[model samples]
Target: MTKMIFLNLPVKDLATATAFYEAIGCVKNEQFSNENASSMVWSETITFQLLQHGYYQTFTTKPTADAHATSGMLIALSRDSREEVDAMVEAAARSGGQADVREPQDLGFMYLRSFADPDGHDFEPAYMDMGSVG
Candidate 1:
């Protein structure tokens, strides 16, 4: 059984991608970080690998998908509170990410904000108060 989860993502600029995620509270795993790649740990279960352009090609034969214009993948993170969700989305924007086409919304029991990373990767930070979700 696998013990750790790795999310491999391709980025145009490793340094910029690393900095963007760092600004949003992710810490780099220096042991696994190098010039062409950086391992940004989100939690014990989640680690996002930011690889330089074309690097991922070495590991997979599949062609890369357009994260912005087409449906490929969406990364989601759960925040502890609405404020935290807002902070993460805002941090992404401040670090070169763009705000989602739809604005943040509150749904009585939950709140969510979506953003696109520098690579045009879609991500969402959402908060669901206990008892509010069924």
Candidate 2:
């Protein structure tokens, strides 16, 4: 069975990145955090590894993608409501990040907004009304 999920990101400044994630409401799990990396917890089953650029290189030979220059992937999170989605995006902006990477979108049952962290990692916070789907 899939026990847990860890999303690892290469960051330029560990301290700055750690603070950015924390500012957006993630909890840091000290047991898996250190100077080189931080384990930011989103939920009991989901954790994000914010690794220093050099430390991240130890795991791969390919050049790390410059998050600011390009989009390799998009990190998406679910919010409880449309207002929560907007609030998160606002928080990211207040925390020295870029908010509204794209125009906010609203479908009949879904609301979404994108933001970029200080390190240029992109994230999408979304709200979906399950009652509208099967």
Candidate 3:
């Protein structure tokens, strides 16, 4: 069986969050989406579950942290090339997200850029040359 990952996020506005995910190349899985939540497929094995704050609370007793003020995690996505990393960031910025929350990093073999969604969920899109890694 193939292992799949589901990233569940608490969002203030479901519609806005859903649109932002779609702008960044995720396709909506209507079979799993509804008014309070949206299932966004990033890849065959990766899906993002965007839930309204109230709905999200039902799944956890912990109070939702304000992503704009505090970051609990950073989601990293691998890209095929440096250009792809830049493009993702660009798409995010154009779609109600912030691009380059921090300075981009470039090593001899790896390149990475960071961004945040409208609610400030952080993401790092990176590219690495396998041949250059030693």
TM per prediction? 0.92, 0.95, 0.98
Model 3 residue runs over 4 Å out of place are none
How many Å off is the CA of 89 in candidate 2? 0.4
> Which is the winner by lDDT between candidate 2 and candidate 3?
3
Task: Give the clashing pairs for model 2.
Answer: none
Residues 1-134, model 1: lDDT tens digits: 65888999989889899999998889999999888899999998889999987887788888877676775877889999988998998899899998764677899898988998898888988899989678
Best candidate per lDDT, number? 3
Worst 10 residues of 3 by lDDT: 16-25
Superior by TM-score: candidate 1 or candidate 2 = 2
lDDT of candidate 1 at residue 85, scale 0 to 100: 91
Compared with the true structure, the alpha-carbon lDDT of candidate 2 equals: 0.93
**Per-residue C-alpha lDDT of model 3 across residues 1-134, encoded as one tens digit per residue:** 99999999999999999999999989999999999899999999999999999999999989999999998999999999999999999999999999999999999799999999989999999999999999
Candidate 3 local lDDT, residue 16: 95
Please identify model 1 stretches exceeding 4 Å from their true place.
none
Question: Looking at candidate 3, what is the lDDT of residue 104?
Answer: 98
Error of 1 at 99 (Å): 1.7
